[model samples]
Target: MTDISLEETIRSFNNTGYPFPEDKTIHSLFEEQVERTPHHIAAMFRGASLTYRELNEKANSLAYLLREKGVRPDVIVGILLERSLEMIVGIFAILKAGGAYLPISPAYPVQRVQHLLRESAAPILLTQTQLISRFSIDPDEAEVIPIDLNGPVYTYPTLNLQPVNSPHDLVYVIYTSGSTGKPKGVGVEHYSLVNRLNWMQRKYPISLTDTILQKTPYFFDVSVWEMFWWSIVGARVSFLIPGGERFPQAIIETVQTHSVTVMHFVPSMMSVFLEYLRNSQSDIQRMSTLRQVFASGEKLTVANVRAFYDVLFIQNKTQLANLYGPTEATVDVTYYDCPMDDSLLHTIDKIPIGKPIDNTQMYILGENGELLPVGETGELYIGGVGVARGYLNNPQLTSERFILFNPQGLFLQKPPLDPAKTPDNNPPLTESFKGVQGGVFQKAHLLYKTGDLARWLDNGNIEYLGRQDFQVKIHGLRIELGEIESVLSRHPLVRDCAVIVKQFSQNITLIVGYIVPKAENVSSGELKEYLKNLLPEYMVPNMFVIMENFPLTPSGKVDRNALPDPSGLFGTKK
Candidate 1:
């Protein structure tokens, strides 16, 4: 095999999707929209709407109070609240006060919330009157400011507080699920987030008349794009009321009532919503106002894509986009627009994750860091501007995952450059930088190892194979659980499914499946036969259990840990 030059390989996979100036921070861009469309509705929750000016003023008031309490550059502020207008305000206020906001979801367990508060070490916390009692922290440890206390904090005058940080300063630190049984905080700078938001606006423009639905919890990175992207473009953001996410009818009604044009969903939730549409016999025309639907956080199966196309896009002009990214890549890094052609849909087993977005580059690398060929499967590494600033307070873990990559030996001879002097400089060194203080200054470019197995297609698209760790070996044959789940999802009666390896003994393990059936009468025997046709016998699950609904994490993805053990269950034989 001929060796491909590093420059050629980089040029082949890099995507300059849409270019936008990165000179401004999120707060500055949001203020520009406020200046242009002060009267436009910026956000709405529970029958209350705040114009751009009103929202800015509320945010400014909170910022003023925060500044009085020593919130400044490099400071970390915690936000604990429900899905309400104040939650949005808290986000902007933290940015305006020159601090990185740590979102603590109200739905999280008390111990988990306490862990985040203690791990992040956020000296200041913003919460409402109702949620103040939920915190397990002592008042002496962190100053708690309740926004709805009917005090001067709420009635304080609104003023423009000049942003004190540069584009590279930390904007937010979001905690994602870690395999080590603890949540890791990913610190994303303003420049990385602004680039993502600008690309979304350019690719799928949201007009002032459009309303975006904010149903995901604020703690998740999906909400980062959903809540702020619309505001940056002067579009209205409609918040979903409490308990609304569990009920499909409530979401549908909110979409119809607000004429929501844009929305995002995890594939599991999307499957449920589509099932609701089919079972209720609802008119697709009523949902015609929805022009674009974005799916991410999980694999978008071919069957779910086809169902969405047949029910929503077949007679309307809506477009379904399949996005792929982890929390470390700032929400999304790649996108694929599902075509309406049934022939094309039938031929593919799994939808391609599509091309990289603007200022983003993806590479499939072998175990030894060599570039893999188009059809060869390897681990996916993300580079370019969207790479996060590494995990907060965990430098060893950060250095392990966020590696330095110089494909062409371009920086081999150059001396180490200070991170503070880099063109896109982040905040000054903090506790998170303790372990890497001396070494990080020498790197040329940081690439985040996604730990996901994928391969490049001939058409320049990437096909995601499941996580590298999710690959299991049974009876000397390596199997990809996602492949099995994909085949099961294609069955007419299977709405969603999850596959796990259950170890019955020290040397023996069995593949078990948990499924949510579309029809009550669907049988596991039929699903086993369906799998036999599509997958090898070794790859097929040994047992199948039907569930009314799969348990979900706070981020809306299927919770694998909550799956019940298949004890005293009979195995299916081929």
Candidate 2:
């Protein structure tokens, strides 16, 4: 670890270049847009468009109904519905009512949905008439409001209602995959969401003329921006019809028909879509209206970048950018716009995840919590305004992940809290501020420890290596699976690949490679030789399995857990 002073470390990590509004909430920002352009189309779904005025009225009606059922600030309301107009209404209503919305996808297993509902301890659940029957919950446990059936019956004022939420109040709780079997809910506050939107407006401003495609599920954190960010800037948000999320043709047609100016995709889905365009010889000219494409949720490979440049950017002036952030950070913390140069893309092994966004700070820290110097790999710790309020209903895990560090001297004067304004049954806010390096000032800000491993580059960009736990030990030599996968991805015949450690017995373990070949009749022998020439003998996978396609998680990420075990055919390592 570098022997940098505490004050120096604070200066190094703080990204104060871009400014963000501290007093605004997501609801307040959207209301301003609604007031500015109430007649403008806010969102479109299946040939039907909802104007800002209509959307606000629908949300206001539901918000009034929710308030009648005792929903208020910090309260978690469950929202179980598919992608539709009602889904968007449910989200806005929850925020307007000053309650955090807990999104549960109706497609999720009954048990998983029930677990999330119970875990959130939501007082009310908003769903459509069809999904209301899918959930098996007692009436006394939580109030179920069917938006399609019962919402229109109740007459509530559709006029603009002032949101009764503080900046620090909870806005939403999104659950992410946990190391353990259960998913952990991350509670994001209005301040963080507002900061993110404000930064986006300054960096990549969207206008009413721009139409953003909303394909991501509501349960995912990215959907937060997809649903509300456009509304803040008076832009139109176009939704993908049900069953069209994974279909490339459907996505392309929607973009062409709706003239979508902005869209986002995970690298895995982007690769598939690019391949569809290449193979089908689709009319890429139709998508000339697209202005930007954002890739995140997984590592964006160089090949995928090249594919976008050659297939998409070459024909049109669409900007392809790589965004990096976990669910803990409100959507994205950093972004890198890919330059249209093949030689430059070929030279670099991985695209940089870029510098911190407005008001967000990124620090590469060693295992012992010491900040590492540039060019050295360490655990990535995120600090600043985007840090969430911590995990919901899991204080122990929250404390373990969210650390306290006050680099700035803002906490010197403590502010008074109003007991009546605070949530009645919510967990008490805990103060765990320890002085920085035993300094006189004892104030500390919360920083989230992202278990991801990364290194600061000479150009000030951060190169994400992989997860710390993703490192696997084989034959007494620890190996980073990402390093091997990165090398394999460069192979001309390999379209996509993933590396995993398979255990056949207590004493026998083997590193296996799963590959999606680009050409027919490609054998494991060719790939083995290709890897051996570039990697050490031990680094090479013990076996290679050619896969037609890798299974994907609900979030469109490569699902390692769903990978089939090859132990049955390959017995053990020779």
Best by lDDT: 1
Query: Candidate 2 lDDT, tens digit per residue, 1-574?
Result: 4454543644544534343445667877888899999999998888888899899988888898888888889999999987888888888898998899999877765666667777888988888888777778777778788887235533789876766888788989998655433567999988788878877777788898999999887777877888888988899998999768879878988999888999988776788778778754456777889889988877788988998988888888788988888778888898888888878978877888988876677888887876677788999988766788888888998989987764544222222233544344222322312233344422126678888899888666889887777755453233668777887898999999998998786436788999999997889999998876555566689999999999999998789999888866665677
How would you encode candidate 1's per-residue C-alpha lDDT over 1-574 as one tens digit per residue?
4565543655566735333445678998899899999999999987888899999999998898888889887788999988888888888999998999999877665666666778988888888888877766777768888876244576666887977988778899998655443557999988789979877887888888999999877777888888799888899998999779767877888888888899988776787678778765465666778999998877788988998977777766678998888778888899998887888888878899999887677888898988787889999998766889999999999999998875454212221234445445422322222323335452226789988999988788999888767655453233567767766777898899899999897435789989998889988888887776545465678889888998899999999999877885546667
TM-score of each: 0.78, 0.77
In model 1, which runs have C-alpha deviations exceeding 4 angstroms?
5-10, 15-18, 149-152, 281-283, 407-444, 470-574
How many residue pairs clash in each candidate at the backbone level? Answer: 0, 1
Off by over 4 Å in 2: 1-13, 149-154, 280-282, 406-444, 470-574
Q: lDDT for each of the candidates?
A: 0.79, 0.78
lDDT score, candidate 2 = 0.78
Measured by TM-score, the strongest candidate is 1
